[model samples]
Target: MAHEVPGTELNINTTSNDQSAEVGNAGGVASAGTVQAPVGTASVSRKRQGSPLEAENPWVIDIIREATSKQIHEELKASFLRGEPDMSAATVFFAEVNQKIQKANDEHGAERDRGTIPGDAYEKLYADFKTALEKAKLERNEEAALYVVQETHSKFAKFNQEHHLPEEWNINPDAFKHDSMPEVAPKPEPQDNDSLFSGSLPDYTGSETDIPDNVSTLEELEREARYNQSLSAGEVLYWWKRGVGTQTFVQYGQGSSKTYRIRAGSYEVYDPESVPRILSSGALSGDPSSVSCQGKQKLQYRNEKGRIEEAWAYTRDQVRGIVGVGWKVDDDDEEGIEPLDLLVPEPYATYPHTRILVLWVDGAVTLEDRAFIRRITKGSYLNVARIIYHKALRQEIRYRKAERLPYEHLLDRMPTRAKEKQDIELGDEEYEQDGEELNSVEEVQPEYRGSVQASTIRSASTRPPSNHGRSRTSEVRFVEPALEPRRPTSERGTARPSPNRVPHKSVDIEDPRDAKIRWLEEQLEMSLNRNHQSSYDSSSRWRRYNRYDGRQSEVSEYTPEPRRRRRAVHRERVWDNWTGSWVTARRVY
Candidate 1:
């Protein structure tokens, strides 16, 4: 059958093997329906000329544009109206019409998967066509829908292989499993209740249970136990489970009741070499099920690696300033009363030296409150009194008025200069002499002044009569009596006349009149006689003596000594001159 194209009014060939093979025109109207028999199964061609991306085929576009609206309407009904619709009959109808259209249009995404329709088409077919198949199955065409499902899978397979798509694109083989599928083994049955609970807890082979022997000694552990008044969390748990003694008690107080599972055992407490294991215990987490003694609740404990460990536990309210004060309990005041009893007290019963008790007494009291409690409360019944006393005890006390001055104050009061000079033995004698010199110089200056004037008068008297004659030496003291000479200047000042200037005998003396003069006189006399004898002997003896003489005499006729060749101004300059850079210098005697 053929139909007219819209807008162009062209007629195109449309009849194919099945009546379903009728095309809709450019008017976009659907084809008439008709029933047809299924075609023989066909394998998809491995060779794809390229994907059906064809606006390339002129024939396909012409066919779509020429077929009329009425023709498409008749074809669609004819394809499904037959006994039962199958893959070949349905595919052939759409193939001759829509396939050619898809091949011609790039926008249809025909190239997206080889041999398969685009995603929109696949979705549209699944919804629309699947619905129709379901309708057919309801109308006694169940075989038709099953056949369509198989064909859909086959089409999808062809699409994956032709496109070289990823393995994930392939349909899962498990989905298609039939009678040939393998069976899986069944899971083991759970054990009975008695068997499960009857089993003993496994021994902790994963880690060692016993603390190392090297951790601490028994004595150290005891000391720590007494000091801290408790055991460690691990030790507490350990003892509770396996220690020598275990006790149980139900405590009632503070508007609540708790059960204590107490354990007693000797635990090593001090490990000087190990890092302190401060624990928060169950008390910190507010578990209310367990209590730990000798533990730092909410405190940081460093291991050897300096990491804060989470494995150990302790209480949160055991801090010193916060003890008995910070913990939250039922029926407690918003501002809690200072607890009379320590909910968690120090392990050691004895109080610390620095502790002091502060008591608060309420006005209201009953006989029972006074009597039965009096027996227990007369002393420090509540640990709080003892703890407060122990925590606040004073070490020393002194009355304000009786107290001695502080060391710094005593130092400040001392005479600084006097104390510094006390060790100086040289100072006492010096001050005495300094005083005497000052007094003598002050009081005796006039007498010394009078003596100086008298000496001037004597010196004036002894001066020469004004005749230009050489003055005779007069003894006059120019300096003090301490500096005056013992002898007169006329006899002692002049050097004694020596016969020779150079004396044979050496005499050292400050005054020229001493032994130097006598030695020089003896040398001069011997020299004079010897000179006379030598002069008389003369010529022959002189020649012979000259031959024997090694010492050369200096030339006596005042022969000018050959001028020493002056070091060429500067020896350093000679080298400089050789290098063409001589420096000038002044002549020196």
Candidate 2:
């Protein structure tokens, strides 16, 4: 048992009578009859080094106990070999062993009672260990702890190896095992941001977030730098400079209908474990037409079988960098990934998660674009309008306290109370069936209602006689009135052409000879009438008629006789035949 010094609770366990004798000589303990030592005076006042008092420091006892046990284990073996007579050694060994066993018991007891190690006791143990190592003049406490740590590690390793573990353990399994493991391919690593902003680009790794560092195309870099000045945090913008555009990611599916806030850093993309950084400055307008990177030019190293292995540590930006000179003028054109386009950057070599925020200004601030702007900015219409004004008008937009702008006022701006329309959610099955019913009702409304109205009107106009006693004939006569006949041309007093009368000779003359003879007689009569008319003078009522005779006229047969007599009677006179007058003619006799 450890001897308690006067006015002290120090447990100094000594083996054999010699050690106890030495301790008693150095510091005497008060006997039962002796004047009781002052309880807290000397012991508390005493300057203790190496081991402090029990209450002030219980750890001393604990360390002593453990050291005692180790000593005992060693002594037991030594004593067995020596075969006794060395009482001092035996006593010292047992004393140390007993102290260590008590300490172990105390520890187990504490755990049983409290369900965990006491905070104070742990502090004591750690302190004692620290003191022991210091006293021993060890180079480092870690060197001592390594023994326990290595033993524990070996035990676990042996167990795992015996049980046939799949592979070696690692804090970063992918970083170590990716290249060697043929079964699982490594995902493309994110490139350094520095490389992407620059114009030197490498291959793309099929990830939108794999934009490079400073290496961007001259055009892309310039465009992005300009756009960068105009963005807000969490505002999703297409970073086309690095070939990471809104259209590039759109193929996966319909993106957030509202603009989703962009997470900062390339690692955040497709890496859920990556802690995304939010852009505090809210860079709004840094959209580039295309991208480039330095991931292609950078190199890195890894530890192999006691040697460093040289390999590429690509960043998201570098992995996406491709060999292209110009921007993709067409927004919809998305190129496929190629091997020659792979890039690796330096900074991404060791950092865990490095991501960049991409804010997309899809269209100029329009009403439709405002919806997405609202989601991304987490702002209201008025707020977005203010942003637009700052961007477009280059001046701060202000509003009256009680008034609103046209666009702002027209938004879904009704008061909460006014917007209390009932909205009940229905299952898909119910919704589809209800929609069908509604469509059917709409389809039948016009056709059936018009037909029904027409039928009702007809029934009202031609109602079946209420009094069935009415005669059917009277009903029919009243319903059907008499009609008037239409007048013919003769009855209307209009003149009609008279029928031609045919002579007996000309009538029904089908033969050509008969028709000709009848036609000549008619012409002869017409000519005779015309000659008689021409001979009459307007002053006289009498007209000279041509007297028809059976014989031919002599004057007609000898026409030369009349001509000779006429020439003798009026040799110098010329007849005006056209006007039927006489006139003198130039004599050419």
Question: What is the C-alpha local distance difference test score of candidate 2?
Answer: 0.30
Candidate 2 scores a C-alpha RMSD against the true structure in Å of 50.5
Scored against the true structure, residue 433 in model 1 reaches a CA lDDT of 36
Model 1 lDDT tens row, 457-526: 3234333222123222222324322233334447548334355543233334566575789789999987
Report the C-alpha displacement of residue 86, candidate 2, in angstroms: 23
Residue 485 lDDT in model 2? 27
If candidate 1 were superposed on the true structure by all CA atoms, what would the RMSD be? 37.9
Model 1 spans > 4 angstroms off: 1-65, 68-72, 78-87, 98-281, 284-589
Model 2: how far residue 223 lies from native, Å: 21
TM-score of each: 0.16, 0.16
Please report the TM-score between candidate 2 and the true structure: 0.16
Model 2 per-residue lDDT tens digits across residues 339-374: 111111122221111121122123111111323333
